[model samples]
Target: MDKQRENLTAADKKSEEIIEDKRAVQIADPSKNSVAGKDTELAASQVGYQDLFDNMPNGCVYYKVLLDEAEDPVDLVYIKVNSAYGRNIGRSLSELIGKRVTAVFQELTGEGFPCMETYLNVALLGEPVNFTQYFDQQDKWYSISAYSPQPGYVVEISEDITEQTKAEGERRERERQVALIERVASLGALAAGVAHEINQPLQALKIMADSMIYWYDKGKETSVEKVIESCRKISVQAGYITSIVEWMQDSVNKAWSDAPEEVDVKKMIQRVLILVQERLRAHGIQLRENSCDNSLMVWGDSRRLEEIVIIILVNAIDSFVCVDQGAREIRITTSCVEERAVIEISNNGPAIPDDIIGKIFEPFFSSSKSGTKLGMGLAIVKSVVNAHNGTIQVFSSNQQVTFRIEFPQYRQSV
Candidate 1:
């Protein structure tokens, strides 16, 4: 209400100025009666235009859009807006009428109005705004529009956009929470499997390094082959631990990591499979592969990809371990399609329950009787897949369950 009162006061002052100017011109041109009449007509015309603007019901953001030399692009500054726009921004029309709309609303949007910026972007391209934005501070929303009234004049209208965005934010949060819960649960159930996975590689590395150390101490290490072999074993062991830690870490944060490096999919898969090979052998799960990328070069951190594959494999292995299932088997095959590299991990266990299939990636949502999992393995798998700009889908039938992942080829220069 205070803002509106200020606008009224300013409008009155402007009208008085127009009247005084007209009177001055009339007195000066009295010797030429026709010229004095023309001045009177012009003043009367401006009065109606100003009156219409002052009486409008809501906020108005009519602005003169400035364009570039090509006239196809709009500049983000120096645009003309109106009195109502000033009120919406808690400023006076007199101070805001000739300023750019972007400058005024930039602070209103929390992060600056992406919607308005987008609107202006389109408007500058000789298009118009037909959207609404909800302003939290003013407890209202706005419907906005823009047009090129003249060569550089962009007239805009903004009506109040509040209800819809709030609903959207609420909806997204609900989905995020649910997903986090299910994934954590899956991770919990797979705890035993993951431990065994890391331990196997460590065990091998320990054995190989120990043997190398014993030979060296006995002074029977006559050949350089012994030292080289021991160093190789220790290297392999450290490599395995590093890989697992990297993958798990990447899933939990959004930090900016360096660009994706070359991934030797075949060798890494074999090494990862080695980590879990004991579990696979114990469960009688068979493994097969065809590295069609020849290099199977994926465009992401190797360890991160390993985590994704490991999680899926662990979940499948867990499903079969349940007492209700009889035929236990999981197989992974790799392939390359155009710019994409794919890995398909399939298993034959009891068919997943219809009720639980879709919600599998949701956090704390578990079918594990072990009570260890909070159900996060598949959820992490999904996150890793998404981060890579890849896709993951599951298919199930009476006899088989298949999880397919497609990734952009690292060699393809994405």
Candidate 2:
């Protein structure tokens, strides 16, 4: 009798708990509530969500990811959005809440919205994604984070990054200005050296002309061979002057305008070699070429590409001057790696110490001679590479410093 009473007591308690659970479910269900109760609960839930949506500092949006027959997200319908979101997109909640994303912004589909595509993927796949978007139409930038709470819904948190982008652009412009100033300063320093270089050939020409005139005036039979040799000397010297002037002009003009096209990589390197060859020879530095392929090509501004090669070569040339008396040599090699064009320019000068190697590409960082302190060459090289969607790196070992640059391969259109 005592055991039966204990079992009965337990059964009664379990039944009462089940009844309480049902009542709780009923209270949560609006359909099970009285009309007034249903309205009150629904209003409370909406107020809670509204308070959360309005309190965020950044723009907040909830979208229903619309799907086609194939179950791919075809478009997005704005379900709920805060005031900040509406203000960001130049629309009000009343105007956008029921509208489709594609209907409002056609450019999104025409060009593409990689960021939005990722957001829809997150909603469909139940993952989270973060990306930056540049809206060309509104000239705004946004840092967005998106995640899905349900199968067909996405919540996006966005912050306007237009100011940040503007600041970055301003910084780049300032760097460009600094680079220009440094380039001008380098030209100023080289002016005397270049004049001296030109003077040597000029003096030689004067001597040759004087000798020819003197021989003719003395009634000496000037052989045709001698006259032809003097003429050839004059032509060579004149050609040298023309080449120097052309190189200088091209270097300056390329900085102002950059138009990209398919460029022959090997041919462009040879052009830079022509410009710097005399300087290298004057310094007793020997140049060795290896692994070069004539057919290698890249899509870029040829003149700008030449500038990149020139900067690296000139830097190597400068290093040779500062090194202790030894065999000065520069090795230029090129190869294709994973469909990317790779060029390695290495010099057996002094090794750049490990501590400063990383900073070599930083703006205004130079290890060059005193009074030539504008260290913007490598900085400019890096900027140009980044603009071209390429990469550059430096390595130093055993008194050898090398700069390795890689560029995307260009394929010709059929």
Top candidate when judged by lDDT against the true structure: 2
What tens digits encode model 2's per-residue C-alpha lDDT throughout 1-414? 999999999999999999998888877885766876878989999999789788777999889988899987888888988989888877878988988877766633365444667777888789898888888877889998899998899999999999999999999889778656655644543444455456656777899999988988999998899899999999998787778778777667765654578888888888878766667766788899986544789998786677778778877777776665359999999999988999999999888888889898888898755855567777878877876789999999977888999999888879
- Using all chains and alpha carbons, the TM-scores for the candidates as numbered come to 0.51, 0.53
Best model per TM-score: 2
Global lDDT of each candidate: 0.69, 0.80
Worst 10 residues of 2 by lDDT: 185-194
Candidate 1 residues 221-288, lDDT tens each?
A: 55787668778878977886776666456544522343467887777788678667767765667666
* lDDT measured at residue 156 in model 2 versus the true structure, 0 to 100: 92
What's model 2's TM-score? 0.53
